[model samples]
Target: MTDSVALWFRTYHTAPAPRLRLVCFPHAGGAPTAYWSWARELPEDIEVLSACYPGRQDRLGDPYAPSVHAMADEIAAALAVLAADGVPLALFGHSMGSVVAHEVTLRLGAEHGVRPVRLFVSGSEAPHRREREESAAADDADFLAELRQLGHSSLADMDPGLLELVLPSIRGDNGWD
Candidate 1:
């Protein structure tokens, strides 16, 4: 991989490379940049990489998938290539991303034949036991409340411009059941 690509997945806040890779998935409406600060808090022995889902960040030009399975499949394929080099890896995800992480981990194991060493899920319930099916596009008040409950201080603060930028992804992801 080129230096920039390598840095994108490997380096963390100018620290030494880690023996294990911790791939993170952000919540709905979240981006890879959200995890940048986490690099400093984690141990130097653990590498940190975050998922850059389509329709967000530099991938905004790409089409967004409408289902969790599709997202999981894509992630599995990418991680399959990464794992081929024999690097141990784990997963960490929050909120909607937790569902993506769980499904992607299964897809990785069954489809790609790669199992993560561990999985960390936060601010979300078990994927299999998820309650209700509320379309994100349908609910504005409740949806914003859910975002607040997920601990998105910035979303809770609700600056008009930021809200304009993030709401589309949130609404899109809500329909991703």
Candidate 2:
């Protein structure tokens, strides 16, 4: 709803005069489209912008983010434009997104002199404590198995064709051979 940099974000819905803007960061092995339903259901006073990562959906050909820090920095720059518009901003993230949101918040202050009013982080460790899960997939088969075990029934039910589409991004996120 703003400018050229909007390309990195997907707006499933928007408000003309929102009390606050919420940017949703997708989890690893996930994409912005998953948050599509949220835009329609949230309060009218809240605007929703789901950040879309590269190498997925409309950015199928685009390269995946090289690292979480790099991705967060890029997202911070995009959010800067929205901040400039005088809208109160907030970030909501789950799992990997939680960490990305934190990093983005920090970058916004240090790099852009902007700060979000609230940062809601869920399903993530504290900033001072970080731990790596042993999800290093040895192969595609292993990666798919991990997803199924992760209790994502959707992954268990995914069609092979669709699975093919999403697996690479997941693997890339996992950073395993």
Candidate 3:
């Protein structure tokens, strides 16, 4: 994989000769590690590539993407390199990731002349139906409440320092400061 692609994608397993590549995008404040198990669960002929957004995990020092469209543009450029390899790609995304994946799909087709074979989205509204209004929690307490409501109670048990680091990405993903 090219260095540029490596910056945005993480591969947990190496497929000897992949028939297809499945690129996964995680939810808001999610990391590439979320899809790490897919490499073990799916057929060996399918390589799994997960998006590793900035400001988390290995890219912790990088700034969070200014917007989802910006994130998609960068991801599309990186995936275009993989598309050039002739292996068919299938995208899977959950929650906020679904929007980013949708944008990347459009970019790959329009800018790179690459069309993914399949696109699977979960837990997100239709791209065109998304509202532009702010949806982020109003404050730390509200953010924690939202996380709990979404079944992310585990985050509540996280180290305070770690939670502090994560909140920014979550808020950023939801289009708030």
Candidate 4:
């Protein structure tokens, strides 16, 4: 019965001299801080805005999306506000965020009439390419094992105590699907 809130995003102030902006979406169980270093690495002309979904880190009390669509909607709204300056945009997403970014890009194009100039997707394939299932609801042991198999640095390298601390929010959000 956890209440969900809007997703969070971080705007890294770049030179802002370019006509385009680049928005980055995080993978499942990821936070904005994951890409903090990316901002400094990107070209100065392409402003970088990294998305940080709720229910983790600073937003630990918020609820994560129960489905991919829900996650997309949350991201779209946040991006709408952050990218409202009318600059052309490009999207980059990895893993779970790739699908969310695709959905959001579609919504932004169809609903807001804001079409991104390009989409850079990694670590995930096209949406219709896979079956949708409640894979996250698998038992914790198996789920953790699966995450390990997926090569997530956070989960794989986490100390038991920190993993214990962070696991609930991940499990809660993952179980929703």
Candidate 5:
């Protein structure tokens, strides 16, 4: 990937000549680091690349993506560069990332002439089944409650300052202002 495209991804393992590239997208409020361990678990021939959404982690200073389509556009462009040499790709995503991944997959095929070998998604409904009106909690209190209710109790226990810094990205990802 070029230096410009590199900003959007974090490669945990640098394969000498990867047989395949596995691109991973994280859930809302998540960072690329969430998939870091996959680098060690997967075979050396499968290089693991994780998407790093802006406004969090290393990209903390950057603006949050305006919309899922915007995220998909940028991600698709980057993946096109990565796949230009014909390295096969497989996409994996969870929750909100699944939607982004699905969009990226479509863009890759239609706009870039690249089709991923596989798309593995979990913790999200099929793209067509998603409700357009659904959104994140209305307020911080409700958001925290929702997180806990969704089995993200760890987030509820996070330091208040840290949580504050991460909430905007989470809310933005879910289509909230």
Candidate 6:
């Protein structure tokens, strides 16, 4: 039997005999598609599982997670169920996802007694090095400008049609409002 929540994952390719599973957590305003190609790019020994948070893309009908911690806790539970036999697990995160991955790692260890083979963080600062960036407090234009300064021009110039589809999930990811 297969896990239902695990089925929610998106992968660009599949490896029938993967040595390990590399679970990817996406950045803010990100979706499972962000790492979909990894399923093909990585070696056959690695199975890339890209998580899709709810209220975005095909999962739009599902309720959004209230906070990063809540999201992490939930995913950790799913991972525990999916883990079996000798299949090793690892995590990778980018931007806001780094924080989510870190929290999930902690939760898996504390609550489920599961430990990932490794935790890889990218495009984000360490917990002690983080500060509340002011852009979240800024108005729309200012926020876009701030994001532009951070080299996220896509956020500043995204098509209105796409923005309408993703903005709410982005706001949920950032815990805005």
Q: Which candidate number maximizes TM-score?
A: 5
| Ten-residue stretch with the least lDDT total in model 3 | 130-139
lDDT for 170 (candidate 6): 69
After superposition, candidate 2 runs with Cα above 4 Å error: 1-4
Model 4 clash pairs?
none
Candidate 2 residue-wise lDDT, 45-97, digit = tens: 89888888888778889888888888887888889987888998999999888
Model 4, 58-161: lDDT tens digits are 77777666777777776676666655777788998888778778988998877777788999999886877955656643576788887777676568778889
Native-to-model Cα distance after best TM-score fit, residue 90 in candidate 3, in Å: 0.3
Question: Using lDDT as the measure, which candidate wins?
Answer: 3
- Candidates' C-alpha lDDT: 0.77, 0.84, 0.89, 0.72, 0.88, 0.80
- Cα misplacement distance, residue 60 of candidate 1 (Å): 2.4
| Candidates, ranked, lDDT | 3, 5, 2, 6, 1, 4
Of the pair 2 and 5, which is ahead by TM-score? 5
Cα deviation at 123, candidate 5, in Å, is 0.6
Find the number of clashing residue pairs for candidate 3: 0
- lDDT tens digits, residue span 1-177, model 5: 697568999999989999999999999989999999999999999999999998878899998898888889899999999898888999999998888899999999999999999999999999778777664568889977876887988886789998888888887787732
- What's every prediction's RMSD, in angstroms? 3.5, 2.2, 1.9, 4.3, 1.8, 2.3
Clashing pairs in 6: none
Whole-model lDDT for model 2 versus the true structure?
0.84
Off by over 4 Å in 6: 1-4, 134-139
- Check candidate 2 and list the clashing pairs: none
Candidate 4 stretches with Cα past 4 Å from truth are: 1-7, 16-18, 136-139, 152-157
Candidate 3 Cα outliers beyond 4 Å, as residue runs: 136-138, 149-151
